[model samples]
Target chain A: MSVTKKDVNYVADLARLKLSEEETESLANDMNQILDYMTTLEELDTSDVEPLEHVIDLEYRLRDDKAKEPLSHEDALKNAPDADTDYFRVPRVIE
Target chain B: MSSSVNDNYEAVIGLEVHAQLLTESKAFAPVSTEFGGSPNTQVSPLCLGHPGTLPVLNENLVRYIIKMGLATNCDIARKSIFARKNYFYPDLPKGYQISQYDTPICHDGHIDITTDGVDKKIGITRIHMEEDAGKSIHDQDPFNTLIDLNRAGVPLIEIVSEPDIRSAKEAYEYLKRIKQIVQYLEICDGNMEEGSLRCDANVSVRPKGREEFGTRTELKNMNSFRNVERAIDFEIERQIELIESGGKVVQQTLLWDANKMETRMMRSKEEAHDYRYFPEPDIPPVVVTDEMLEDIKEELPEMPDVRKQRFIDEFDMSDDDAQTLTEDRYLADFYEEVLLHAGNPKAVSNLILTEVLRTLNDRSIGIKEFPISEERLAGLVQLREDDKINSSAMTEIYNAMLEEEKTAEELAKEMNLVQVSDTDFLEPIVDEVIEQHPDEVERYRNGKKGLIGFFIGQVMQRSQGKANPEMVREMISDRLEQE
Candidate 1:
């Protein structure tokens, strides 16, 4: 199976990825290749195979529910491109 | 007014709670789940849904969910499956969300939430594991938005409940009970403001005694417990009005505008088939052994409900008081420590629940951050119990304890809060008060019984608040009778 040009654009639109034409074609090819590889599982013919939820069936490990200090305003806004004195700055949100 | 309240319409409420598991690592990858981190810094290749990247389950998350299942008395499935829920969003780097579909790890549970002298069981249909989507900030602009992947791939357990709730108050109690359970299990932080735990309510109204269900509206983005209750109440009323006015209640998803205090339609509700789900083939199926289950079961702590009941039976505290004390593990532990120190659970519960809790609430403080140690609180209760300090003096010492670091005993001693319990010590002061207040004494002698309290106050004023009221009252009454 292979991804058509339409399939490439559809996935890019769904994921909101601003993909160039070349990038789209390349990703489509790569995903098709991966999907092709996954087709090997069909040969196993294990219809009754059960899926696993957890690797280990352990019960409870709990942390002390104590309140701790949160990050400072500056630290919290470290990654934001724009920040105000106490908040991360953004444009007007409402009309 | 909601038609449910006016007419014979019964509101059916179900809650979908998404609790971010308190794991140090992300759900599908080993990235740190710490809050307020740099955006996209913690995202691994799998979380970003990069090509050729596969998700590996975080072992700690599974253990946490199992612990919750056991605490809630649910059946833990020996097998379960992870399916990809296909959706498109900028923050969801993975075009589809990797979540549990049909088979969940836990199923068929019930939580009994008691409120207003009524016990009601809210049925939990399933608790399934899933990865959280990153946050979308629409404040950037009306037409533009920014994405923060810091919360992406955080492990979460979605506890979906049956529509067993009847009112907004019942919904609040159910959510509160769930928060306590998760917090007690040490699985989730249960902080609604931080988005660690969130509540989504599916509300509908049916004519009373009708077997058919009403169309439901989903309410989301509740930042606090009060908002959850308020939004549901408003939506229920809105739907009831629409239905009563000969309009059909359309099923849709709504975002709660906390500032506006109204629910705005976000999108039409999607059915199960809308998100095309298929088993994720990248990850292999997980299998567990009986030995592992037994080992995990052994590590379970005594749950909140069991501990609350035990407090009532063991400490002989009233059910209402016991429930309040045992609601939080830290407060419960503090109360237990006070009992250990004072050897009087009854007095300890009263002081902690009534005095300590009231003070904490008044200051908007949490018990985990309470400054006074349990041993010190026990000292205050002991002083009052032993008549070392009168009740009036106890409040003064309590304040001093907060402002300073002295033990309750030391402060009571230093501030002269020791009660003058001896009538011999008090009789002299009482005589002085009577001699000074001759007019009042005459009025009391002329059959004014209420003036006895005034004479007692005079004695207390001469001795400060340290004089025991009972002893001073007896001395003054005897002296007046003799006169």
Candidate 2:
């Protein structure tokens, strides 16, 4: 129910984020407060109510399995941080 | 590192198969799901995990998984929710993959497999739909891993099995059954070499009568069915040796190096899969109604098991023969279609097993791609069945029909491969063979009955392979027995 410093660091690591000591502390505090605030809703005993997966009540939206035009290789890689002619280059991934 | 297989210990293996759905579009995007395209050319913004992009479900993805579930006898979930599994990898751009965690779409299914002639039912833990990650090419580049996003959002169904597989061969059979069912449904192409279908194994070892399971290791990067079997065999051996040497097995992920035939630790990758999964908020729950089940059931083709059993029962063929004939839907259909025209199940099956399958393997093509059709092949089998041509003549006619557009009989006549079954046509050849081989005939008359094979061979050679060996045997016996 509470966010610890190690939890914040672990989550930051998973998200590939590097946080300073100050940012980590503040983020932990903020997340704990948010969790504490959200915990109040749990006290209402809404166990009888149905759990909704999404906020919107619309029907399940599905599309036909038809291919549409995709972005060209150039347009697709235009925003990559580092890319070669055909691939997005990244640090070596050890298998 | 094994001192032979430890019979005191048994292996426990469970497979997780990821089958890429054969849909035209990506799972959550409308971009093409075509394989072998130029790198990243078939990707869309949503597939690339662009900001402010939302994913819509593909209708066919759900339907295909449902068909597989039904084929595997899974209890179709009335309602299923998608979940986000948080992780970090170069191939996964979303940082979190949209998967099914708590609520899978299909569950409690079972697949029956035969390992060493022992029929066993491997329980299905669950089958869930998810999207595929992009390709990561590590060996292609010198320093960095090259990534292609074309396969990022392609549809996939992950089939998880219960830990019922107790041997490497059982794992092989279980994987084969899964592949057969998916291919039979026409949902997945089941091509493992090109990454259309992939399997991961969790292997462990336990004492023969132990009630509890030992620590398990997850194996990845096995690209072929044979590799899957070998990797599991290696893992089982390694784990058993580790325990026998007073060493404890560690629960971690291992990568199977097929070249070296060993499993190595995938260090630092183990920490990346804590996978804090939660219900996906973007896509709503997919509800499967009764009507949907009925419609999909009607659309489901005859599964491999049913068709295989029918081949055994109705066609009166052996289990191995029926199995070979029904290995694929198209192959089985070709068998029946040929039978419909040829009217003899046994001969048609024999031709298919030997001649047809050899052609399929030799050309590395499927039944659909092979030059001969069912009707044409049936004509060939009918010739052999009606005794117009012998088996070798049938083979010759079949090979000639591959290049020519003529029927089997036409090609048989053109190549002088038709069988000579007439008593008048074959009597002289038989008589000539006996007269020429008088010394052998004397031995044959003195009760060396096996020399009849030599006599038949000579007669066949003299007639240029047109003499029916069975008929020649009868005619030669009648003349040789004149006492």
Candidate 3:
């Protein structure tokens, strides 16, 4: 399971990251190493083992349907990079 | 042009509908899930993806999904797991959506719909719970997109249907049935324009005899049921045209432009999201116990199909009328309530189908907002049944009732719209009509039996529309015939 330069670029595009050619090459190598390390699990022959989804065995810790108070508009947008009135402003995205 | 184009090809369509649940709070946060709040005011630390906050599943969310599952006859999974679908967008504050990936809560359900009087079953592939993303308003500003996190943590259930729909009309029927079921269960409001209920269709076309499936494209941006049908039709035609012109159908995502009535490419498969899903660690797995299933099943309201059948059998309604009446839960309830008072199902159904529905459409209000009470409507129908009012008089009284705050009987009396069936009172008016229209009376005696209608009309007009038309007819005929 080796990661190629094209795979790295495709993933980077999906993540909306801007990477240079040099960085792309270096990232490809780094991802391939991680993939190779993950391949070690395939060597284990545990055909009967059930796949684990979570570390804990807990189930159904739920809250009631009643609503609680939420943040004020100012508090919610306090940490935003840019805000206008009551909205967080970002670069225009065409549909 | 369409016949030749569609003759050799057949369309295959499947729809994915996202219905936002009417839960009081966010799926995992305590923040209010109500729509139309000021921007960002509905946000909580858990919904905003603050570092230290953890998510707690909402009990009502689970119950709502189970209700849907039972309504659609889906097999509720004994154990279901929530997974984090990793994606990045400004509106997705967590950089991932908590959704059901491999282990959906419900599966293998089938919904029956009728198209052209033929029943067809569309298979439900799966129904999974998820959280919604926030709104991004692009047209609000010239250079910036505004984000509102009010909807970010709202609960949703995505219903995926099998590719069993054969045409645009079938797809339309199937979507309507889905909406009806959700609305019946009271889990979702089923308002497409408000974004509470949204749909995306997967459409493809193939030669009529081909057994293998053709390449398909996913269509989005259709906000209404009509748009969904139109978009599927347009996509099917576009695919067939491309194939006939020696071009291959490419799988992609397209947006339906309702104004232009065409679908434009949004993105191709290469740009599709590879949502790397992993089990959600913050929230635990949901287990449906036998008791829980029983409770949900008992609480499930009668679905649309069953109610439609009962209407046909019980009320002796036609299939079409029954279908229309049961399309909305509230409308069906209103029909039953009127039936209790009127004691005549067919008459009530007809009045509701024609008069009540017309009024509702004119005012753009639902049955919930209709001004006339069930008892009042039933009284109006009863008046007509009892020969107390003619059809025209009934219509007049009904229209007047809409404007006045009075019962049907009160309105009938105030407007002088009741039929005067008393022979003693109508005989004088009938004799006067006969005496004045001697030419018509002579014609009536000469076997021009249709002139009886003219005499009746004159008597009714003289009585200001209060004369019983049938009694007037009998008297006019007898008086003219007497030597």
Candidate 4:
């Protein structure tokens, strides 16, 4: 369950994080130490221990299922980084 | 026609729904879950997955999830734990999402869904709590995308159902039922367009009598119920054709292309071992006490299914009518409140489900925002019952009621909605109309029984439609018999 420099580099690329080689190596050590500490739970016998799922047990709080008014086109596109007359358009999203 | 070949094929369908809980707060932090706020304004240190921050449980979220479990008849676990579903995505600032893996909150439940007059039970495998990741804006450039953390850390309950569905219609009905139940329970707003509720379907095919499962492809990005079923159907047929041609159906994740009405592969599927799931240590194990469970159970409200059954038995309403009213909780509650005042459950159900619902849908308005209150709606129904106005005139009154703040009685008085009661005063108008239309009156006297309605229409028209329809009919029939 330990993280290595290779693991750090792999995750960085997957998440599109542009990290320097030295930074990747440093993070690998830090993550590995954290993982090592977390493994302490594995040493405790949890075979019979039930996993806790929710903080409390309650059932069925329902709101009426009706469609509320949707945002107007102008209000919806108000915060778009780039916009045209109507649609929120950025640079070429797809080729 | 290959009828026998069609009989040999079976459709296996399963649903994976991601329901964003309608809690006031975020999943693991105290940040508000309000929709449409400033970007990243709701983010807390823990939500951003900062190094020093840890997640504290939001009690309301747990109550919400448990409520869902109860509605679905799920087994509520006394304890549950969070695990890291290891995945690397830009929007997921934590690198790995904290979710329930092996030990889900509830499991082994079933729900009954009706499609085309047939009822079937769909098995629920698990309902687990998970924190959602943010959105990736891939529209930035040809090779890159930006990330929005506003959606990140939103709480979600993923309800995974067993592949018991057979046809596209059945899948649609099952999805609708799930949406209804969750919305009725107030756990989720059930807004597909807003990404508050989302569904992913797994489709596969097998030869008749085959016990082994066929290779399944997962479909995503279905914003509507129709799209969910259509995407599954198209994918199933595609797999069937491919398999019949001796090609293997690849196991992968595919995104639904709404424009092309097809599914394209996003990535090859990965096994559980690939991401390396493990217990999340940053958060402690969640514990559920008996007292908390009891409090939640006691607070559970009436679900739609039960309420529908009650409406049918108590109100003597038709199944179709009851189903329509109870499908939306607000409409059902509105009907109930009006019945409490009007004392005519059947009539209230009909007017609300048919006339009121039609008006609401036509205007694209919500029941909550309807200017007509329950008391006023009941008053309208009562007026009709008391012979104060005819059904035709009731529509105008109802419409006017929406724009007018006055009560139904007040509006009736203001608009002169009272029916004509004096037969002596009506006798002259009826006689004048009969004398003026001698040909129609002669036709009616010569056994043109249907013409009686025409004569009554003339009287009502002369009275400006405020005449009591029953009294007008009585007067017209009596005068016709004499002629």
Candidates in order: C-alpha RMSD to true structure: 6.0, 2.9, 2.8, 6.6
Give candidate 1 misplaced runs (Cα > 4 Å).
A1-95, B1-6, B38-54, B140-144, B267-273, B421-427, B439-451, B477-483
Top-scoring candidate (TM-score): 3
Two-way lDDT contest, 2 vs 3, winner: 3
Please write out the lDDT profile of model 4 over residues B1-483, one tens digit for every residue. 245755777889899998998877777776667777655555665655667877766777678888889889899887777788877555677879989888888888989998889999999999999988876666554554555466777789999999998877888998888888887887887777778889998888899899888998888999988888888878877887887779999888899988899989875433323566777776666666788889999888898878989988988888888888898777788888998889888778778877888889889776877778999899999998888888887888898988888777787778876777788768888888988998987888888889878888888888888777678888888877874
Q: Sort every candidate by lDDT, greatest first.
A: 3, 2, 1, 4
CA-RMSD of model 3: 2.8
Q: For each candidate, report its DockQ versus the true two-chain complex.
A: 0.10, 0.84, 0.73, 0.09
Worst window of 10 by summed lDDT in candidate 1 chain B: B267-276
Number of the candidate with higher lDDT, 1 or 2: 2
Residue-by-residue lDDT tens digits, candidate 4, A64-90: 222223234455445556555433344
**lDDT tens digits, residues B1-483, model 3?**
468878999898989999999999999988899888878899997777788888889988899998988888799999899999988788998899999999999999998988998998899999999999999998989999999989998999999999999999999999888888888999998988888999999999989999999999999999999999999989988999899989999888899999999999875554567897889988778999998889888998888878999999998889999989999999999999998899889899989999999999999888999999999999999999999999899999989888887888888899888889888888788777777877876777888988777877888899999988888877777788885
Flag regions of model 3 displaced more than 4 Å: A2-45, B267-271, B362-365, B422-424, B481-483
Number of colliding residue pairs in model 3:
0
lDDT tens digits by residue: candidate 2, B71-186: 88899998899999887788898888888998899999998999888999999999999999999999988899999998898999999999999988998898888888888898
Q: What is the lDDT of residue B177 in candidate 3?
A: 88
Q: What is the C-alpha lDDT of each candidate?
A: 0.80, 0.88, 0.89, 0.79
Error of 3 at B320 (Å): 3.1
